[model samples]
Target chain A: MSESYEATVTDPVSAPMTCDSNPVEEWLRMDRMPHIWCPGCGIGTSVNCFTRAIEESSLDRKNIAIVSGIGCTGRVAGYLLLDSFHTTHGRALPFATGLKLASPKTKVVVYSGDGDLFAIGGNHFIHAARRNLDMTVLCVNNFNYGMTGGQVAPTTPEFAIASTTPYGSVERPFNLPYLAQSCGAVYVARWTVYHVKQLQRSIREALEKPGFTFIEMVAPCPTLFVRRNRLGDGLAALESYEENAVIKNGADTRECDLGMGGPIVCGKFVDIDRPSYLSNQVAHLRKVLGDRYVMPDAWQGVVQ
Target chain B: MNADPRGVLTGSHFLDGDHAAAEGALAAGANFSAGYPITPSTEVVERLAGRFPFTGGTFIQMEDELAASIAIQGAVWGGSKALTVTSGPGFSLMMEHLGYGIMTETPFVLVDVQRGGPSTGLPTMPAQADMMQARWGSHGDYEIIALAPSSPQECFNLMIRAFNLSEKYRTPVLLMMDECVGHMLERVVIPSPEKIQIEPRRYTRKGPDEQYWPYSLEECNNGDLVPPLTKVGEGHFPHITGLTHDDRGYPAMNAKSQAVLLGRLVDKIRNNADDIITIEEDGTDDADVIVVSYGITARVCQPAISRARAEGHKVGFLRLVTVWPFPEKRIRELAGRVSAFVVPEMNLGQIVREVERCSQGRPKVRGVTHAGGAVHDPEEIYNAIREVMG
Candidate 1:
């Protein structure tokens, strides 16, 4: 690694010190200039969408927690001007799960990769969804492993060739919307990078959704997926998405399918109200910590 | 001196290791215990459920370990001493959040009742494979404190100590117990709550409406490395994520930012080892042979020590109560005195390397290990002790 690469990797943004930058942009560390994304990764788009969503959501910036796992997509949390956590690989869901459960008032969002979510963190994803925990998960599905060179992931197409598989990938990719819906997620959607407006709207909706909400953003990995498949440049992938994609008008997961991209289903898929884990927990806490909670004066003498 | 000090403790019955752990957390002023049940460790949750409600503390059986671990931290930030308990599988599930706890400097106690596993290896049986993972499982380089207790009594006592250490250092403290110790029916006495010295992390109350930094380390009266905590609902401080952060709890990724954040996380624990690490050395001063063990394995080694001494061997015992601060200084001193050190454990030689490192090539340190459900036979340790004497 050159001094520049080492410097880039180490110099992370904290406490948005960039001047005249939007207050939100001020939250970003400017010294950590030039992130480690490929020239045209869609994660930057999603990061922009997320920043816009947070700005539009009108929640206190300090009260929001953004957690990310390893991958090119994981870097979104690093640049955000919120209480963000950049956790280890494949563990972002659990970390965000903890953050959400620990403080119910805080809006916890997991900005992660397809490999980290579907491959390594599948168990956590299913469980978090099944329990209908209120959280926002933005899964950037670039269709390849961007961090460790382009390799076939659980979200990769059935016959995509990459560094790991000399031949095309034999395994079928996960239909994430269906998986999340089956796992009892109350909100689920799939959107490609070409539809940045729709992606941003889905994220905003997911943020306000009262239960587990999952958004699968079909991002282009120019270095891995494009280079391996010999697909044209990022513009080609974005153009392909714009040409082939079909948007579902209503919030229905059954209308979405990744294998056959009919009605690419980019809306709030599930929005039925369900009891969240924290609300129930707070009720339980209120029941348990009854009189002491009512009479804060009692705690003063007791601590002394 | 009378050899038998078995009755030194004020004994209480029906208080197994799990009950002891829960009661100890309660006594230490823990106001919340969020847990999901797994074998051997379930009793901790069961007991907390029955007790927490009455004491004005919250006890929640979450949907899973993932939720329970976070719920514990949340309750802690909500102005309570919070805790969670689980077995090996659940502990593995909780490791990511545990790393979050380290990065965010969250104070909570995680009781991992060890069960066998590479993956669901032995849900019902005991193994100490997680000993290494407890410290190094997470991706980043940071320090955490873990304590191992042999008896139900120590389970109660050490849990209180674990909570205190967690509060003092502002990091997660792990109470590592195995199935043999966790599920064992043992007599452990609960000390009177007044008798227990409860130390809480300082809360920053300079002004209720002032800007509060939840992660800023305030020098306590004792010069300890703990920040003043402000709970969310209390309307004081802001809490942030697992990112390497600054004093104000905002995320930072710069090299210098990481250096300062990582240094604080490590230095807090490293600088406080003298106040943290606890061990027990028996007959070590004049003995040529010694047996090292902890948790239930130490119980087995205790009788082995007595039997070996009766058989005219100069055998001693070094039982680790606090394992994470590693007890390097004490082990080094023991290595200079003993001819050979025998480490008999329930897991395959987890702590023996520490014994070896401490021995510094002076004494022969041998590991005697078993990974199954059964406790180590007293005679096996007795034999190892004698062999070391030779």
Candidate 2:
């Protein structure tokens, strides 16, 4: 654990909006709280957005499943009252991918963090998107590891101060939106806690969208990223988000080149058509296993 | 060998362990398999993919090990018996969901054709190193049923038992085949469908789904344990999680729920050990020396056992078919009768420790260890048996 530094920090507090509209409170694991997040962290915003999205869609609460990996943000599934899975770090994607495939009728959503998604689970993420497996992936990009004292991660901004990079981070961060789009996310979006209405809207669209849908929520890590950048308290980080974020159209992913000077583009990036993995699998199985199948109701036990 | 007079299955032919495993799963009524190709165990998937379709079942090559595991779970949930095959690397990737299957009590079969490992240690080589990992790798305290096949035909027969135990207990059943049995090609007699007894999944037929609780436990007059399970769309249950949960499947985070759930999950197997565990002993009744072996190593010790006994030495063989929920009582019985127990395995003395643990000082147990792709020479085992006789 790191020492708590005194804040000569004068971070402005954004006006409090209604943050407590959790529709699935009865379904959540309340005792695991207060979640291991820094005070004023935006992961709570993403979790609220997820619960709100699920509520708004009006999907069967019982059929809905939430799978998460190891990280502060990944623990969102633990607190939610759904069929939640807190699996091994960086493994939630594959686990979720499997869960969705096994029970395709069930609504499967993966909630993880940048490190969980883009670092350890990077291969599974890209491949799942490529395969277009039917699932929603909500990645909370907090730029650094919050659970382990804010270490540098794949999404940590360059030249930023983190536990591992005390001098300054020289490694470049991944452009998650562009990478996901190129890998074939039928629906892709990026939003910050700063954009509640827009974030909620993107989430709703993703839920309705077919195939692999990815939403990268740029949450604030006030205890780490913001504290070190002297960016102010967690609430101030959202205020700065409002000031600096450029929410362009989804097509802006093509124009925002990383390694070159350009604003980070955040919006609903891609929505398109593709036959999902499970549907195609079902079609193939139906065709091949047609004559052999005994309909469920009429099935006479296994063939001798 | 001649066909059985009952006409249930053709007699054994010269076949390898891999072929036996595939035919075993087929006989056990495995109709769906979704797995990615991996070494040693790849043949299991390849054979299943070809046979399942012809048998009127589904076979899918999942994107990865993780997806394969989930797909198998789904097939089982869809009311189809399914299985997946993988080795060390793939198995490592599947540890988390393997735990998921255990927690959900989803019945499925996983064939781990053991290979050398830490990372990608030795893929083609033989190793029984995953024995402990198979039981404990998936987090949480839960009982699992694992079987080791000592011969090509045993692989075929044990796989059938694996599925049955998986279905009855509602737990993931592991068929631990080392690279030796996994890669070695041997002919196996295909059992006629008439001879195979297939147990269809037990679904609740209660009226109106509300009365159904998917995980409700039931104890019969004879005190047999059964956990309630219903199909997904059926009105039987609510939520299921990796977390400690109540009977309703809803997440329950109290000690009371944890104690109850964990106990039931484990007790369901422990209480029914007689029905779940199986082993074979050759000349163990009055032997002064015994050889405890399983899977491929047991094959090497087979000839040695016969030779030791032929040489006027009271040497015997104890072959474990059920590796976990281990044949504890039977091992104890053998300990009392035998003077020494010799364990031959293709790994660094893994199951030998189990033999020592089960012997309880009644018999001196020693390990015959080997690693890498090579199997132990029969002569080595023969020598070990002789030394014990002296």
Candidate 3:
């Protein structure tokens, strides 16, 4: 609706377009676009899938809140037409935890990047999972700190070239799915940006499930990660994913690690039910206090 | 508004400063507290953990102080009155989130039970070293309000005041209690809920269809600079960020935006210093010398001031109940009248600098500084007062 956005869409040389509506426009802050993402960056694609998943889920759109930390993918919260919080670096998980606990019925999602979540926010991630807090954690693993111009990250593949790791990364990358499962995440999944439909479906499934749900979207940083590592462009990265990616449901998360230029194992590796943090707290309190037990006002409507 | 009766204990009980503070927070309608355990401050959360179950509240022991600090801010946005308690080292970890809370204008209480520090100096001993840190620890040009309580009763009374002030201003308030005050057991009377005054959260009345901006000047009342808050999950769909932002709460990323945002953040407390400041004074009407102190040092200065007064030295006592605004006006007024001002604190002269700055070289200002691990000796403070008089 802004003049700048309209200016971008109207090209005098192009054929007259008849399409009047975009399906995702209803879920986006159209006025804020022209976003800052570089061309061929897969963060936009991942966001599209996420918005589609939210549309397909049973959650009330007004009741859904999204929180993000400092990164390129962290901008997703700002773009979304929902209650959004752009918090400090590596602090989104704990912020979302407070939001979810304070308003139990509200569906909270923490969306950030690998460097922001795994590298700096790893402690929060593990603790949030271990407590089985009810929230969805969607991480875009671009293998480098894209916003900070391609510094080395925790999800960066071993022996991969980066701004910091010019010779090669000597440290091992985290198998995120395995870490999520080990930390008691009830639902864990990973999908590349190339697998749009599958990623959308996985997100929808995670949104519906209870307890700590984590999905890692292995996106391409065309300007930074791909360029520095000689991995061609974003299109080439997608093409490589098409050729080397294996979709194996119920795969062992520990074996899903990716080496440089290796096969990317992607699937929903963990899905089991467990009592969430609030439920467990309520149950324990009810047993101890008997008739004196009172559910917190925030949890009253949902828990009873 | 009167507090909720369910949270009020409604009777007299012997309590430590920490327990009294916990009771005060609950009575002030703090239904959520996320804190990591640290020395001296651990008792506050331990009491909340035991009491929140019956009071229909939630207390989460977070993984660390960093998580605990920001988690409380999230809870505030989620439509809950919240707080987080910590000691010296943990308070250091919370500095970043304190800035975050200030930038977003999130109303919450951060109770810092002060202990020895620089880096974990003495976890079990008292120190007022964090006085400067409480005011300027966060990175940026912003202002915050801090209170110091010297007794269990003040802890109970001032914790409620702290939350009220936070809600009134829509900013984080610090209850700065040293280890001496936090662990000292004393008589505290929990008044009935109706007797306790509480400031309910200032929630915006705007509906979804209305044009509501979270940080707009339109949202703030004339002369009262705090904008009303909108709860998350409601229809407002507020976009809050730590970046220098416009009235709409979106990042503006420019100097003009930074000036506009930072100006209000600083002015809200500085302009309203008179309404926010609280000080207890005795016999300053005809005194040549004034002894200024806060926290545990204020209690220690009592006997010293009495001894000086008994000798006809005309020494007066001034206790800083609200320390952050520094009671500048009173200091300026008394600075012109008094010949000297003596400040006794557990730190190596943190607040004495403020006193000297406010005095503006008119009065001779002296700091009776002490390192942590113990309270200042009364004789030392008396000697400083006598020397300042000379």
What candidate 3 gets wrong by more than 4 Å, as runs, is A1-21
**Alpha carbon lDDT of each predicted model:** 0.75, 0.75, 0.91
Please tell me which model should have the higher TM-score, number 1 or number 3.
3
Residues A78-103 of candidate 2: C-alpha lDDT, one tens digit per residue: 67766566666676766665555445
lDDT of 1 by residue, A1-304 (tens): 2553333222235634566655446556454457778766788877877777767876776666777777888777667655555666676775565545445667778889999888887877888887776788999998888999988889877677878986888887787888998898877778888887888787888888788888889888876687568766677778878887876645556556554233445655666677776555556556876554421222333221
Model 3 alpha-carbon miss at residue B189, Å: 1.1
Worst 10 residues of 3 chain B by lDDT: B216-225
The digit string of per-residue lDDT tens for model 3 on B1-390 reads 999988999999999999999999999999999999999999999999999888888899999999999999999999999999999999999999999999999999999999988898899999999999999998888888999999999999999999999999999999999999999999999999999999988888888767677998676668778888998767888999998888888879998988888998999999999989999999899889999999888988899998988998988889999999889999999999999999999999899999999999999999999998999889999999889877
iRMS values for every prediction: 5.4, 4.6, 0.7
Model 2 chain A, TM-score vs. native: 0.86
Q: Which 10 consecutive residues of model 1 chain B have the lowest summed lDDT?
A: B1-10
Model 2 regions more than 4 Å off: A1-39, A58-63, A79-81, A254-264, A279-304, B1-16, B26-32, B54-82, B92-106, B116-122, B125-129, B135-143, B185-187, B190-195, B198-268
Candidate 1 lDDT, tens digit per residue, B221-325? 555556776654444435365666788776566999999888878888888888898888888889888888888888777787887778787887888888897
Task: Give, for candidate 1 chain A, the lowest lDDT window spanning 10 residues.
Answer: A295-304
